[model samples]
Target: MASIRAEDLRIEFPLYHFARSMKKRLLGVASRRVKEDPQNRVVISALSDLNFTIESGERVALVGHNGAGKTTLLRTLAGIYEPVGGRLTVDGEIGCLIDPAAGMDGLSTGRDNIRLRGLYRGLDAAQIAALEADAGEFSGLGEFLDVPIHGYSAGMSIRLAFAVATAFQPQILLMDEWFSAGDADFMAKAQTRLEQLVKASEILVIATHDMDVVKRWCNRVIRLEAGRIVGDEVV
Candidate 1:
């Protein structure tokens, strides 16, 4: 069964060189009146002592202000970032769309990217070929699929990436936010496709600031504050 459990999860990013020096200077002035820990390194804590469990069939929404660890948590769950401390277990095949162009090469053609992304997702040659036509049709890029992605606009890139990403069904789907770059007509189609994909997945976790989306699509809402989950509510 698909499931996710995180116990006291902690993730931090260490600052280096110029960034480290700047943080030190800023903290030094801010800490003169406050107690400063000598062992505290110049690091940004993204997740601290976070604990959560999500079972199969749950559509969970991560809701919080910017910098509240929503994206970090999603990335961590997607296996793009490892926990610095504590334990995390995920039991399912994960399809992550944290960044639409994550596995795509700007220098490569859209058709080539479909092949590359399919291979990266562990699809065999035959499977990739089977999905190529559908991906091309959904993208509406026509001859542009034959050209390099670098020549494509942001909306065009999103179309190709979305088409390729959703070509295969996943046991667990992770999305950072709703894709909103396309035109009105494309957006309507994309939203429909996205809803269908989400329904097909066994587990879905999305981080977004749109309350309407959370209300419409998610069954549970997890609110985070300063790297910790402050509230978890079932809707």
Candidate 2:
């Protein structure tokens, strides 16, 4: 079964621009002892002492004000950021929709990107062919898929990206607000696809400011403030 567990999980980022004196002053103003990594570089804690377990069939929403670590938490779960001072275990095939075009090569054709996505996921030739066919049909980009992605418009790019990212079913799905491009028909199709994906996944974690969406799709909410979880509730 796919699951996620965090034990006193802590994530931090280095403050490379801060002088020692400035760091000291900031630490004093914050009234907290400064933490340094093994290399002794000053760091700002992004998540602190987090403990949680997400089992199969959980639909969880990460919510908080801006800079409250919602996005940071999502990134951490996706393995984009390593915890600096704790343990995190995730067992699943993860599909990240954090940024639809995040890892795409803009200079490459959309077709090339489909093949690359297949390769990254370690799909066999038959599966890659299927993904290409699926993306081509779902994205509605037709001949544009053969052209370099940089030449596509914003809506076209998002459609292609979303199509390719979701070509395979993942055990765990992670997403940000993420649905802002395309026309009305595309929006409707995207919404349907999102619902289908969520239904098919073992676990779903999303970070969003949209309370309506949370209420509609999530069963639990984990709220954060200043990198600490303040509220964890079953909706």
Model 1 agreement with the true structure over 1-235: per-residue lDDT tens digits? 8999999998887655666567667567653122223466566777889998999999999999998989999999998899989999999999888887887898999999998988887788898898788899999999999999999998899999989888778889999885978888889999989999999999999999998989889999999988889999999
lDDT of each residue in 1-235, candidate 2, tens digit only: 9999999999888888767798777666653325666777777788999999999999999999998888889999999999978899999989888887766898999999988888887899999999999998999999999999999998999899889887778999998988877888999998999899999999999999999889899999999988999999999
Provide the lDDT at 149 for model 1.
98
What's the C-alpha lDDT at position 25 in model 2? 72
Judge candidate 2 at residue 19 and give its lDDT.
75
Global lDDT of each candidate:
0.87, 0.89
Backbone clash total, candidate 1: 0
lDDT of 1: 0.87
